[model samples]
Target: MEKQILLQVEGLSISFAQYTKGLRRRNLQVIRDLGLTVRSGEITAVVGSSGSGKSLLAHGILGLLPYNASMSGEILYKGQELTGRLLENVRGREIVLVPQSVSYLDPLMKVGNQVRKGRKTAGALERCRELLARYGLPPDTESRYPFELSGGMIRRVLISTALMEEPELVIADEPTPGLDLTAAKRVMGHFREIADEGTGVLLITHDLELALEVADRIAVFYAGTTLEEMEASAFQREETLLHPYSQALYRAMPQHGFQPLAGTQPYAGDSYEGCVFAPRCPYRGEECSIQEIPYREVRGRKVRCIRPELAEMSGSPGKMDRSPDAENLALTERGRMA
Candidate 1:
């Protein structure tokens, strides 16, 4: 049976204004015609190298993009369109974020207080206490500040906060990106609990194996577009990929990263044109640079490349499609998002 729809993102585009100082600021398109959806009780993992706009997409859903970045798209939740302040209000109630940064804890305040703060209702507060204990964090630790906890502990606290409200959807961006292997499992366990309860999970990460292990479905992004998506099980049983970008990603990842820490990640971007991966794709014909984009379908997947046949042989894997190929690197490029 088809799962009930929870969130639908359509034709979402984000652009930034380039400062030429003396001249009129130019609009640099960041995300172009991007679209995806999350359904109830499903674990949909969004994978791409850093700067592939994975995080940006999450922020966009929450209506949290920077002041300078402009966005156009229809985001529907329970059939209601999302934009502006309405999106902001709807986020924490129906959708909550486990940010790339731990938003669950106040670095200055006690951990427990933060969780309770996230919980607006008395029942949610009680649930928060239960969840923290369920994850093995002493309800007492809520008394401690973020600086005192270990990286793993921080993850737990954040998960507790995100789930404290028991929102129907979660946007977890690299939930355990920097944790040790043991810590990663614990964190994932918490997420598993949420999924088991029928929450829609949008997991953002570059670890394909991790997705293979846990995700019900996987969506691969490139150069601000959702190149393809498929069942995570299929990635393991066969190579059956329709998008060149997705295939390269599978090849580039250190297959064992999910179970054990291993290997370095490919850089986010290298060189590209037209299809972006044209510079590295082995199957590239001269037309790759001529602006001919290839797209195809295999089983239940949709690919956004000119040559889905050679995605593995066509390009290097494990990187964003030429990093933030567009000018909109992120809300504030002040810190060098690239």
Candidate 2:
């Protein structure tokens, strides 16, 4: 049985036009060659640090990029191109976003009206009450304005709003930021239920542990592009992970050693050629810095690194043997830095 691809983002890039001193205009590329797929009946988690272009990816999918931003590549929903027209018709209906910020709620609108999308009909009102209650909110919550709600309450309200529509695809951007552990787990469980019901879920969050619990697969983001996309089960062992950055992230988890990876991610405006993770990678070589590394499939996982050993290895289960050449590259990098 083939899984249905609900949404596909291929070769996606977003750049913002900004003016510098002396009225000089420059294009700052914030996202480059970003790609991911969300399949029906499963959740695909996009895990990355803040400013790694996660929210921007969500916005790009919905054709909601800001005025100064220009995007290239294709965004497909249900095997059709998701353009402005299609998105305009289906944006809040077939495709929904549980945005990270609670500011998305209108201050002037009551919570119930907002959830029901300004409808006051008895059915809409009853449904609104049901959703609020499901999330542990009282029936009176619908009468209150956004300002009257606490931060955690607002987060739950956002989830309720997104769930109001029977969306085919749900893009949740940091949906559990202000939520407690219990609430966050419940939110994730609701998304899991949605996926089980044959909807596609794109869970964008910095919490890798939480993602591993709910998502079937994880696409790791670095700087502005994806470094690795692998099964959530692959994260159970460091050796099962493909990209170095992915391994670093796994090791940084609290259950792991909580080890920190050195070096900062490159700024969006900073121009760079070759692998974006090269500057911090232990096995970085001259080619890593000079050559354009292609995103390729290795060991059943997609990775952007072009290391020869990674290319040669099959998708069999075992520890990856670091090629002597890679070891030398690491040694050479250390020597050069010294």
Candidate 3:
């Protein structure tokens, strides 16, 4: 049995012109040469800080970007190139998005209408009730308008609508960022349930804990490029993260709080021949400043770094996978001795 490939994004690049009375600049490249794949059963969490273009990437896929923006890339859904009307046709059916805000719901419409409108078919409408019920919302909440629903109730509806199509892939962007811990857990639980049903999920969140809790794979994005991608378990392990940028991020977390790698993010217009994170990386040196960001090859991890130290990364405990080095060595030595 094979899990289906739901969506494939290749060479996806997006740019927007920026002019805020700054020293004359033509444009800013937001996301560049970014590639990602979502199989029908995996949840790939795109984690990064604010203004890091996580949401922009999701917007690029949805065709929701501003008209002034330019995007060039391939977005394939179920082996078909996603484009114009066909995109509109399959968007709700094969792909769905749960935005960060529940207010995205139409205030003028009843909750039922909104949910039913989530999908075009009568089957979807009927399933709307089922979805609401599944999330523990009263069936009657469907009859009420958006304003009438509580925050938690509205959140449930927003999630249910995205599930209406029984979509093969769901792109969730910080779906629980503002909610309380309880609400966030419940929301993450919904995604987990969706995944269990054989649907693929690309869960995008800055909350590393949230990503770890729900994601099977993690792709850490810096500036605009992928630094390192590994299994959720590897995120905490110091086994070796082959990129200096990712190492800086790994250290920046308060959980680690190791050293000061202080510097601002590179301006989008800056000439980044080297790694985008080079400036803030304390380990960076002469080679870094001159070299183009090289993509290093590894078994499973993609390291967009030139001075990648594979041995150091293979088992560095991430903020989550904090095991003492001696214990890990003992286990490895035992395996080798066996």
Candidate 4:
């Protein structure tokens, strides 16, 4: 059976307009030429270090980008373009966001009311209690306010709110923050269950190890762009990975010796002509700094780097699948070899 694509983002770019020292306006491009897809029955995790625009990508998809921020590129939901009106209609029903900030919950309202969306009916009340209990929150949690809950409990509450909607697509931005290792794994397990039940989940996190435990595919974000997207299994072996940053991430894993990559990610507004990772990449050539690299396929994985020879050396040699246009950005050929 063919897996259904729930959400697709193609060539998405996000920038903010700012006033400089002389009050002159300038644009800070935070995300550039990013692409990824989420499919039903799978969790697609976007992993990157801080300042890589992972959170911004979530906000862009939810149509919640700040006023000063401008976005270009296409966002499609269930094969239809996501417009402002359409997003408004489906924002909380068909699609839901488990925001990174616990502050998104109402400080004044009782936790139960917020989760139930102010419904007094018996079904809503029973459902709310069930969700809270499922996350290990006590029955009395409903009567308490946001300030009354611990960081972990509040995080669980936020997850419950999104789950309450029975959403087809769940975008969780750093959902495991403030959680201990065991608790974090538990949270990820819940998302795995959601995916197993056929909901498309886009989990945004900085923890590569946790992502590997639950995500079907991992899209590596770097300097506000995606460098490589591959199956979570590819991460098990350093040599199987496609891009340098991804290989670096695998090396940084505790089991892999925690080898750190040198150099910091470029600032958001810093201009770059070619690959953003070129400055730190050991294999970078002169052309890497001047040529525009297309996001191409290598052994069925989506990678933005133009180093096909490196991919071939890694045993991924094959004809690349090209995107016809920016809009349909090569939806990863289903059932292809990972």
Error of 4 at 281 (Å): 0.4
| Tens-digit lDDT string for candidate 1 (1-338) | 99988888777888777776787787767676666778889888887666667788888888888998899978888788886666777677778988766554566887777877744677866787787788888767767888888778788777777776668999898886787777776676677678879999988876665666677888876667677777777576225666654554555445513111122222333334567556544465787888745444555565667666665443333332433333243322112111
Writing each residue's lDDT as its tens digit, candidate 2 over 217-332 gives 89988788988888899999876777877876766677876655555677798998888988767667789989888888887778899883652333232333345555444332
Top TM-score prediction, candidate number: 4
Residue-level lDDT for 106 in candidate 2 = 86
RMSD of each: 6.7, 5.5, 8.2, 8.3
lDDT for predicted candidate 4 compared with the true structure: 0.83
What is candidate 3's lDDT per residue for 199-293, written digit by digit as tens? 99988787766777888877877666567777777767444555655555555555765432444555455667666766545455688778676
Q: Which stretches of candidate 4 lie over 4 Å from their true place?
A: 311-338
Clashing pairs in 1: 112-142, 281-314, 282-314, 294-305, 294-306
lDDT against true structure, model 3: 0.72
- Candidate 3 vs candidate 4: the lDDT winner is 4
Considering TM-score, where higher is better, how would the candidates rank from best to worst?
4, 2, 3, 1
**Residues 165-185, candidate 4, lDDT per residue (tens digit)?**
789999999988778998889
Tell me the whole-model lDDT of each prediction, alpha carbons only: 0.69, 0.82, 0.72, 0.83
Off by over 4 Å in 3: 1-4, 19-25, 118-125, 252-261, 310-338
Off by over 4 Å in 2: 308-338
